[model samples]
Target: MVCIRCKMVLKDELTKLGLHYTVVELGEVEVVENISVQQHDQLKAGLLKWGLELMDDKKSVLIQKIKNVIVELVHYSEEPLTINFSEFLSSKLNHDYTYLSNLFSEVQGITIEKFIITHKIERVKELLVYNELNLTQIAALLHYSSVAHLSTQFKKTTGLTPSHFKQLKEKRRSMLDDV
Candidate 1:
């Protein structure tokens, strides 16, 4: 589950199944008892209705952890990234940077760098819409070297400068919960 409401849906489904889960964190859930095959099947079916997958592999597990980390950092955190993103990801996932980068590129068909950039741009779009923070503030919050850097990167990614992106105020911001 990627959002609080998604967690709520999972919780409701678990309750309907009479299952007692101790924790329902992003990327995982902990149940108090072993579920029978029949119960598992039913629970899986219910979860499927909400478009949630029950992942059960080491690599997919790691991928989800990586996504969760990126999602949290970009969409949820308010502070600028403290260090280089590669180092931040390496420490968070407890894996070497090269391994994580290779695994992510192999599985997702895109480098983790691209994924982070897309998420950052999406966050910039949201911030731009709010209009509470100026261009300089957005650049600082997202850890761009300066407003010029953020503008240049934004233009490269979206084919429009930050001011142009902001001018299209009617455009919808990508939802973090979906990504």
Candidate 2:
């Protein structure tokens, strides 16, 4: 689950199954009862109908958590990331940075840094399309050192400079899920 609608659907499905949930945050749910195997299977099947999966594997869950944290930081939050990303991830997920990086790369076939850059670029595309903040403001918002740095990364990722991208009629910006 990556969005609010996803969470709402999951909550509805859980209620239909008579399971009481205390929380239904992105990528994780805390149910109040000890669900039976049949209930678990029912919940999984229900979620599948909504194009969601019930994750049981620890590593997969951890990977999802990593993705969730990045999504929250890039798309949802306004606060700047004060700490180094490695330290932030390590502290948040309670795992060594090396272990998390290795596991993320092994499981997702992309390094964590690459994943972050991809999302950041996507967010840049979003902000540019919005036209509310100029390139300088966007650079500061995304923690880039300067508009030049953002422009370089943007061009490298999308084959179009940020100004050119905004000027285009189509203004192609991918959805967060697509990223």
Candidate 3:
């Protein structure tokens, strides 16, 4: 549930159930009102039908929140981030960057920074597929130091230079929902 469609489903379900949500993110949703045990079970069952789960454990919930922050930063926001990914994530989640990194790596089997890079690269691929933004613009928008850096990292991650990736007709870009 890292994509817009997933968020929409969660939001729509909450509305249908007359439950107001403060947030609907990957692996978790925060409802505004307290619900009965039966209602909670019903909501969880309903979400399961969409292949979504209601996250419990505090650590898991925090992890999902962190992932949601990154996803929101990369895929949803129109404005560029003012800080680096580590600082931004730590600040947003109110946790030390080191602790967050350790927790994320331990649970997800990948570092938080690597997860961000993967999402950023996926965003770049989407922009490339659209052929709308030039490399320079894309690099700037994604906060890469330079187009060269973006190209270098992009090539390293996908095994193809951005230019080559742009020219290919097939779908090289991945779906964010798959994340």
Q: Pick the TM-score winner.
A: 2
Q: Report RMSD for candidate 3.
A: 5.4
Q: In model 3, which residue pairs have backbone atoms overlapping below 3 Å?
A: none
Candidate 1: which stretches are off by over 4 Å?
Answer: 170-179
lDDT per residue for candidate 1 within 33-110, as digits (tens), equals 998898788888998998988787889988988888898888888787668888998998799999999999999999
lDDT of each: 0.86, 0.91, 0.84
User: Per-residue alpha-carbon lDDT of model 3 for 69-164, expressed as tens digits?
Assistant: 888888777687768778888888899999999999999999887898999999999998888899999998888889999999999899999988
Write candidate 2's Cα lDDT for 1-179 as tens digits: 78999999999999999999999999999999999999999999999998999999999999999999999988888788789999999999999999999999999999999898899999998887778999999989988889898899999989999888887724334444356
Return the TM-score for each candidate structure: 0.86, 0.92, 0.82
Global fold similarity of model 2 (TM-score): 0.92
Q: Candidate 3's error at 96, in angstroms? A: 1.4
Global Cα lDDT for candidate 1? 0.86
- Tell me how many clashing residue pairs each candidate has: 0, 0, 0
